[model samples]
Target: MIENYIATHLIDVAALAILCYLIYSNNILNQNRKWPFYIGIMLTVLIISSEAGTIIAGNANGDLRFLNIFCNVFGFAMSPLIPIILLAIYDVNILLTNKLLMLPSIVNMFATALSPWLGFVFYIDVNNHYERGNLFIVFVTAYILNLIILFISTVRTGQKHHYPIKAKFTALSLFVIAGTSIQLIFPSVYSSWHSVTLSLLLYYLLLSEFDGSFDALTRLHNRAAYDKMVNRLDGRKLYSVIVMDINNFKEINDTFGHDFGDTVLKKVASVIRKSFDNSSTCYRVGGDEFYIISSETDPVKLEHQLKCMTNNLEKERKNDGRLPTVSYGYSIFKGGKGIGFQEVLKEADDQMYYFKKIQQDMKKSTQTS
Candidate 1:
């Protein structure tokens, strides 16, 4: 038992040190008011301190009732904060900058504070061991609700912004649920905080990859990310390639200025993101060029999706009335180069040129005017 406590404490201490170093050294922690990162750090510290309390109580042969209560209180208070902090990290406006989101956490903390008298969360015995109270399930229920909200909010936010948020949030929620459930079932096992720390490390790695792979201006996958995807497609997965170009883009830039050109690009990227499903990835492969690689190679679905994008672009043109429009063409792999990825790209490029020519011939590009 003593050896287990020592190991858990050492791991928690090392994780906290690494996390502090990462926050200080990395700029991600500084962005978006840094509230998310601050909350994460605070949560980690609270867990670590709680673990310390546990160790102390154990060392005292459960004689330190105060220490045991302190540990349980900290743990209880962390339940509501976890979801709020995650929402903040994902730039949920209502949660991050406003005190409204803090209310739940504050309430939980207050209730946990009254645990000694009310026995609402947990109780410490004269021997200093901890046990759940009558209303202990209330806190557990709150945690479950928090996780569900986090999952739903993350999915909605991702869809609204065309971001792949599900990967990050899903993994995080699952880890927390699994870790905390195990700890709740077997309190003496003492593995919850360590599991959470491990999850944090994994999330950091994922965030780094996400930050590195996406374009800063347009928020689409960058050319480097495109190359990475191409490398991964070793002919095992069937794919269809869609290539797009903003018509009269150079003229739009020269006439409206670079800032306006940037807005146009953002608008087009937004359209592309909204038009495509999660099965496809959009990449900013060039200044005015984007490539959408769809895993679904079914000809009918590809055609339908392509037509939807075309109709969407037409609607966008109608809305803006004067801004330049985008032209796109897609090609399903037809076999060449022993695999045909490049063949599909070349065919898509050809089709894009064909599509652009037709558009120019039809409308004469309302852009220059």
Candidate 2:
């Protein structure tokens, strides 16, 4: 009976660990440096060890085997430490520069190494069956304590960062800790269903984090996220702004339909992405309009770049046999004009419409000639 129970828990734990690792891996691939992958790696290892211990404890008879005992001791002991490392990673301020956040991982490793001295936790006979002793309390208690500490840390870090997903993360952490504790204390609840529950929570958190800063259609920072970043920038830094509007975009939409109009917008967004450096912020402010902000750009160089881009866009339009044109207006802040951000943006907009009118008039005269 005990054998069947441990086997079930083993499978469930393994699945949860794998799901967690996938989430961590996805974040790393997306260039998110705040989440450390090592924490997931360690959790996976600990889960595997615990699963093995469960198998030994259930199947073996007579005495608890050394491997079985060691796995149980380390597995339960190591679980809580995983989230502490994760908390450190989530707190970007400390993780970005402060180095002391690495202590939990190091300390957990030492604890894992010393676990074998508890003979009562695991004893073995020739049949390889394992027997548990009274000191299982020590292993269980250590695991519980770690979970509590990590839970508190995660909550604190989430609040400090003002992460939108903070409540979700906090609730998931609490649920997992509660579920694990219940399973340990009341072995009857240890089942695959519990694992599924934990896995679902992790999956939701991962999805939230993945979509946190991006717009699904344009792959640019969403307005909400962009505002957050803008609020964080130093006021003294000079950031040049470029606002561009597609000429007669409404006519294009009316003629070709909304789908094709969307395609054009995407094409323009891609052009901006390719032209600007990684530091620039590009946003689609409205239908047929985009804003590009770049820091510390040289005015002359920026103007040359804008001209070159216009020429290239014209070439593209000719190749496509399309009549649409893109016009841009930008301003470089020399830091002493006493101009607010919105004021500079207004000036740029006026210039854009003025130039756009000139282009329209030139086209009309050419047709008349």
Candidate 3:
């Protein structure tokens, strides 16, 4: 019995450590304010409860740390909330007014806190072991509700938008929901494995999302990532897509060598990264072409940013005499409708060519003079 308990405890501890590593390494903990706190609290509660259960089971025979069971239950119950909160962080506008969606999480935490007096979760004897009490039903119901909400939210969001990484998230959410639901039905066999498996799956999903969407060279999202965002078009949001290319890029590679061209591309990418919001996605689509899909659809802000970027490039050219000028064309989601993403891309490309032609004409006129 003691050996079995120790082995289980070891597995639980390893799971928690893995969760912590994923949260830190993925940088999700830093992306949103409440996500880290919420996920951290959930994991901490589980670790404490599991260890307490193991120690109590080994030494006291069910008499102590009865509260630890409640902690474990509530922590597992509330785990589903993590992904919902994460999705909200990704799509900030969707759940802005949905505090009710959090009622289940709140209730679980409250139940954990108040379980001692109410004896709502479980009670223990002097031996440091525990058995589930009647109030566990209430906790289970709330937990199931949280899991349902998370699954629904993930599905709805995945359907509403086609982010390159959304499918992976949606699939994992379903798995979590399915696994959690199985635990609810067969608590004796499924409970311990559910959270551990879900945590591991989530870690892989996050890693895959990061790699598929992010450009290694520039640390910006890649073309596949941009396609993911573009395909999910709701006619209500205001935003613009900016397509830009560095003029005469091949000449740079031919004259200064590919290494210098790469340096120039990095410089351009850095400028874009510094110029945009942390939430905004940037991508390198071609050798010298880049795309910035500003979810901020406001034409005014879009124009302002593009103009500022253009002006800065001009200033750099004046100072260094060799700075690359970016030709850009942007299209607003006029009234939240457009022909098609591909069409808009083509329009932007055409306008870019027109602008490049004008620049060439001006250069020739100056040479003739």
lDDT of each: 0.75, 0.61, 0.62
Q: Give one digit per residue, the lDDT tens place, for model 1 in 146-170.
A: 6676678668866553456687778
lDDT of 3: 0.62
At residue 350, what lDDT does model 3 achieve?
81
What lDDT tens digits, residue by residue, belong to model 3 across residues 345-364?
A: 77777877888889889989
RMSD in Å for model 2: 10.2
Full ranking by lDDT: 1, 3, 2
Candidate 1 TM-score, C-alpha based = 0.72
| Model 2 alpha-carbon miss at residue 162, Å | 18
Q: Model 2: runs farther than 4 Å from truth?
A: 1-212
lDDT of 2 at 48: 56
TM-score of each: 0.72, 0.53, 0.56
Error of 2 at 68 (Å): 5.1
Maximum-TM-score candidate? 1
Distance from true position, residue 178, model 1, in Å?
6.8
Q: Of 1 and 2, which scores higher on TM-score?
A: 1
State model 1's lDDT: 0.75
